[model samples]
Target: MTKSLKTLLQTMPKPLFGMGAALGLLLFLMVGIAGGFWLFDRYNSPPLGILESLSEEVLDRDGNLLRAFTTDEDRWRLKADLDAVDPEFIDILLAYEDKRFFSHHGIDPLAVLRASWQLLSNREIISGASTISMQLARLIEPREKRTFTAKFWQMARAIQLEQRMSKREILSAYLTLAPYGGNLEGIRAASLAYFAKEPTDLSLEQAALLVALPQSPEARRPDLYPDRARRARDKVLERMAQSGTIAQSEVARASGHPLSAKRHDMPQLAAHTADRLRRQAPKDSVHQTTLNADLQQRMEAVVRDGADRLGTRLSAALVLADAKTGDILAEVGSPDYVSPARSGWIDMSRALRSPGSALKPFIYGLAFEEGLVRSQTIITDQPVNFSGYRPKNFDMDYQGDVSIHDALLLSLNVPAVALLDAVGPARLMERLRSGGVTTELPEGGDVGLAIGLGGLGITLKDLTQLYTTFANRGHSTILTDQPRSSAERQADASASPIPVLDPVASWHVSGILKDASPPRGAPNLPIAYKTGTSYGYRDAWSVGFDGRYVIGVWVGRADNSAVPGITGRTAAAPILFEAFSRSGLSLSPLPSKPYGAQEQTLAELPPTLRRFEISKSWLTNDSLPEPAPKIDYPPRGAQIEMTRTASGQVLPVLVKLQDGRPPFRWLVNGKVLQANGNRRKVAWQPSGAGLSTLTVIDSAGRADSVSIYLTLP
Candidate 1:
């Protein structure tokens, strides 16, 4: 039995042998996976925890952000909304970060192997293989130290997070946590910072940029290294195509686009406003903005043109806001924004050169709001010394006993200063502050008469907000980033609706304020406008309004250098007018009359004088009015006989005056002589040399001069 059974004994326990083999294989496999995971941990350290919590955002009425991002100071963060994001973007990121993202539970075994091989070979650290879940884990539980042990922990944590969160949740966290560029984290913030738009609104080229950025946001910064960014963007597009996320045609088309971050061009004014709004909003919530992209572009162009025409290193700041919601619509901080070479330094318009008489409207407005002045009230436009501080008008011309309406319309510095003194600075400041102006005023400083004429350093934002109150009829709602619900807002106003100022006195003051606005010589579009210039020709500003929108503009050098000749009306007001004209919002015709209002009469007009409508051609004799014959001007160089009369020398020169008025004065040898009413008669004695040139000045400040060329041959 021993010999024969020996062979059988060798095969006595086949099942036992099989069990041992299986056990050994299982142990070997377990050890290998453990080692692989350990190695993965050693090489792949978790990301550092950057932001504490997700950033908040503010949106405009149409859900467009007035400003971008939510932060403390320059802190901006955003999370991608998958529904709003481009599918190719997600696919491209997945292709780069986790090729097997869909199939893998959380970790990719083959990727670990390749990454180990590369690390051991000392080649590039290319194989990330981080699934969406893994990225989420890193974001939630980031490592304090970058070490082998930390990486293993991160992998484990990633596995755990994958088990806890859904695929969509994981993707959202990665999108929100991924860094893009320059203090901007997450796809949402990155999209807006780079594109001035949301992730959902991203174009194909823009999507490629966002996806490419996660590789190395700083190195691929489109603004800084556009060439490098272009290369990276191209790579992303290639990968996206390979992944079947984008068509080859799409890739080619996207590749052709220049790697220009137009959206991220970072409008200087918008950025400055964003910074300011961040400070004003809740620390955690995003401040939505009311920025109008079209209007903003127009304002920028206007400011730029003004600066160019003035031939100075000028900067301008402007702000437009919705009267009903106090939502800022458009803003400009400077004439030139920072080029990448400028190191991203942006000048805030609200912080630029001091606003001159631009601030007068507020002083006068507050006075009117407080029932201190009426439109027809006579305000002496003479100079006055307040504690040895005398403020004079820009022209230094005195118009004694000018109506409040006229004084303000002309922006007379002395009159404004006197009114400011009467209203008191403390109260004025309070009113301004209440209305959302934030300029610093001198303490215990007697707001001299110049105070009413923009003697203080005010910002473009300050003036815009001040005018906003007037546009809203004396009651101002606080500026907000978010669109207000009907319940949240006071009330919605239709176009052309009369303002809702309360109390008869307050209403009267509003009227005075409106009346004080410069007569916009064009057909009345329901608008109120004021112009102001600083004394040194350093700054000029215009603030105006319609029932729907309030706009403010400033024209001045960024460095406070003088612009010798341009005035606010010439520079800033025209820009404002252009903006209004381009906006296509017709002015509501002026109301026939407000309810409960009575018309008041000023100094009676002379019975002998009556205004008559006449064609301009009739005045110039260019073409006659209907049913009238055109008359010729006295034949060029014709002689005139001067006969002395009691009223003046009756210099009779036959000239044509059709249906319209003509130059009242007759000039000889270009000498401008006073006109006796609307009569073209020149009392001239031939002067020597260049043939008497005669010129005439009209009431509207227009002049016509002609050379007689009197050859006394």
Candidate 2:
């Protein structure tokens, strides 16, 4: 074997043996490079956590920018959505920065060789071989100094980034983190700042300008150095033209385009609402709201314009929503979010305030539902005293013997209070709370007749939700601003909603309210609305609804200071009318009268509903039609011990009625308890050990009440 090996070696060609040796050395070099890369990757991973540090954004339902907040470092860095960005911009960016971005792994060797040659020929550094991935590494972990050591680590990190992320993700990171002068970063910030528009559809010249800015952001900022910025953009266009990526004609046209020397502010809509939701969930990067950007913009303008007419220290708010689904489309928290005198920082839409006559519709709705009154049923609007609680008309005058329809249309306080005195106040509050209303009541939260005349507290948001029920034919849904998936949003427009009234009674309410006069000289739109003014002119409210939309407006001083002489019809109703017109929607007619509901004239109704009369004190009548209700058991000022069963359940106290009409309803502490008809008795479980008021309302709209103390046994 030794002799044969010697013979073969002696006979082998020298060039072939040298060739084998070279191949072995090359293989050894390749393995060493692979081992080095593996170790580098294991020890120094790319700072991929920077991806999570993007600015929080709030967008409308269509993914349009509504508002955005800066990052922890106070930089305007937004994510670049490739689908929304123009594709031509991406091509121009690649042609100028890294032509071989798609083919190369992390670095382009040919470009590096060309740069080396140029540096040697010119005796100065000319260019560097930085790919998109390398640029992304530098952006996430920027180094102020330029050195070989820094370059080496940057190259290593680039390789790591490519291994961990896809090519598209790497390019997206570059687009998101690339600096564009001052605190502005990302393609989105650049476009919005310089162009005052989205990056979705960039012109040829604009695209080239954005492509050139990130290379030397501060030096080429158009707002700071217009000449340098233009030169840089022309350089990019020249390169694109030479590479056959763009036509020379296009290059010439783009070269002459002007650049703005000013920076514009980014979109800042829905300020109060966006701040609230962002604070609620800080970690969420994107919040999709139910707001309509176009409608929101229009409504904001309306509020700002109306602020001037409201005089000093006065502010306004409005909430517009879908009647059927209760999705809040446009909500203005206040006229100016930063105004000092108006206390504009306080979101008036959510702040509790007096609703005034805005709730009169609910009172009339309950009356019609209980068969106590018809549209044509006559009820006296004269001044009345209820157990020392006196309520008068808003104008301080009364109309004698008016039909129910006219009484509601006028929003007469006397008629409303009389109706509320018939129905329990507790019943109205509970009905409101069921539909997500936060009712704020005074005097221990157990209300009196004053509640029927803006005595209770409520927010514009809750008030709007209540009016949405009247428009939806008595069905009510909770108002929501958070956007849902398309499938989810359209799924249950007619699901089981909270029933504010039966269809028949709701139609009767709408039937009477549609005739309420609109703002003076305003277009007579197909809508049903009510206006209200609180006592002392503190809050003015107007809420109206077409077939498709419901809007509520409030004009007042946020500090709760009275702005005298500001009535709802003059201040708020005009705004409400304008909001619907600016909504970009044609007013839809109110719902047709539902089945089993027909307009009735006087003498066409039943005897009980013909005239709602419990007492005629103003008449010269010695004979009364019926006696007022009386609470016999648990007499007024009576204190009784509460009993409990063995199972830790409190026993209910029984209430007996006397000397009234049949079909009686009972109330305890202004809240209605379980009532029985014709039996004259009710069983009530006392809420706790305390003094409580118990009242009884007969079918004739006459009430008798008593106060009792239940002591714990």
Candidate 3:
């Protein structure tokens, strides 16, 4: 063996032995500490759940605060994050409290020694040596008095906190627990209360004020004692200068900055909506909604003014949104959400009330689609009866041989009911519901023509949603305020799944309504609008829409008491117009006229279409007065949620027939499913997603189909 190799081998063992011995000792110490902590974990552990107790927040689409609810303790304590806080504030806080915060484990020996010396020399407690961790322990489990025994217990808890959490976590909890005056327990609440802003960005004066308030919150309340508060803040600024946390040149400027003595009220926009979301998800700490806070505030003011001017006991609600996406931008549930006398706590926008003639446009639009009439088609607007149901005009007079445009604009009840009879009432409501408009007939009521003229109860929201079909030029979107909902899933479910009318027909209908006369003294905005009054003046509604916006207003008493002289035009239309004017959005141009839309005089039109003849044109194609082979279970424009099996296969869609001859044939997406099956029900498995047209044909070859969207829940 070489002499050098032997010498190296002799020294390697000693070095290896020393390294192994050190690692073994370290492992043994860790095991011993783990055993000790396992015993310590049984009691006196930190209350970690306290960190999770936070205020419930409601924020608008742009993260602007709309409202917030205090915790059960009646304290506004929002979770604090180091990233969301101003770094300058952190620097000022640390410099004033614990300079060796980051370097120490839990307690700083230097600080303890200095505090001890100062106490001994002065024969009294001169200064505190509590690190951020120790302060956090006291905040979590506060002591009744500042005795030496309590201090030792706080020191113990401080060590536990340091062992259990990171330095950043400890500091964040401290920031969150730091008490400000008047039930504000966090930097966020304090900032919003005093400065009407967030803690994310702070001025030097603002940071100093915040840093000094937690020391003596009540005594230094800026709103209660401005002089003491100012002195306390200035002292913090002076300390920052002395410690060089902030430049000496900045102290005078910060001190000269004035402090706000008045406390701003927390935002209270969309009170009803916030309450709704809070009830929906009681445990959620934050609810992000698709609302514009500023617009909601302004809209509420408009509602408040309208209700106030209408005198006592009359409350109004306004609902508006982006027509294309159906994102509700503003909803004023009541004029004064807290008014006890008016029962304004109720959300009138979602309450069921008679729509009156507000639903007439949808009927007319459907008629135009079915080739029953055109904009200029002449129709008799006289008293009419369908079986036992007789309807008269709202003014108790009839227009002889009036154009469809005039009939609709006048909201003649007879003409509307006449058209509804020609086209099935069930069909009209089906189309409305297909477009996401919720309507309800009286209990045990059958489908009838009276529904065309305020015969059913509908919410203002559903009424406004129906107008979106006209605003979007035939397509409809479901209104929602939830941002987390999948818009793409709803839109991509099908190709115009809920079409109210064809583009050409919707254009004709919207054009006629666009010429509707404005309420007295209201601006002649480029929008198509209609108004309605319930049978007994219990509800008045007005819904209008431009190209991109749809707004609806309701004026009535919550108790459903009729108010004399309250008409749609006089009570609701004014509020609707005011909403548009105050919406803070410029009107978008109405949809362009469709290519197939053409104006024709009676003489130039097809002989059948020259006059009102609904049964002759659309029904003639099938050569039947009534359609047969009806699919009943899954209604038109219905969305069926299919379950997936463990094998990842979608369940089959069940189809039922209301009336059909025996030995029926079923087809799905034009593919034969059940051939010559006598049973009324059948199942069809879809190959993919999107709109599926399910058709059933009876022995007589009379066929009917219903379109539905296939989705998974």
- Cα displacement (angstroms), candidate 1, residue 126, comes to 17
Candidates in order, TM-scores: namely: 0.57, 0.82, 0.78
Model 1, range 1-713, lDDT digits (tens) per residue? 69879988887775755777999999999999889766756765444344446565544445555444445546566656688787767766777678787777778788888888887788667566555676676666766776777676666867655655677867877888787778877887787677776777677888877877876888988878889999988888887778787899988998998767543533333565556666676564555556765666677777666555444344566777776677777777765666332212355455635567766666666555555555556666653546545565564346777776677677777667666776677666666666655665456655445456555677777667666655554555555434567655554333213322333433444455455434244333457777777655567787777666877887765555444354687677767766676666555422234355444444432322111112222122334222221222333454432222233323233233222144355444444445545543333444433455555555445555444443221
For each candidate, C-alpha RMSD in Å? 14.6, 13.9, 18.8
Q: Regarding TM-score, does 1 or 3 come out ahead?
A: 3
After superposition, the stretches of candidate 2 with alpha carbons farther than 4 Å from their true spots are: 1-28, 485-498, 614-713
- Top candidate by TM-score: 2
Q: For candidate 3, report its TM-score.
A: 0.78
lDDT by residue (608-709, candidate 3, tens digit) is: 787884333222233334335667556788765454433555556556674445678888889899899877666667887788898888888989988988
- What's the best-to-worst order under TM-score? 2, 3, 1
lDDT of 2 by residue, 1-713 (tens): 69999999999777754777989989989999999998888886777787788888988878888888889999998998888788999999998899999988887788889988998899988887788888898988889998889888888888888888889988888888899999899999899889988899999999999999998999999999999999999999999999999999999999998877999988888988898898888779999898998889999888877765655457899999987766889999888888896688888988889888888888888888888899999998764657656565665446899999999998888788888878878777766765667888875756777888888899998898888777777877668788666666555443435588888888889888789888886788888899998865678999999787899999988877555356799889999988888788877888778888877888888787899883544332335445577775666787665544334556566666655666777776777675656666556777789899988887888888888777754
Better of 2 and 3 by lDDT: 3
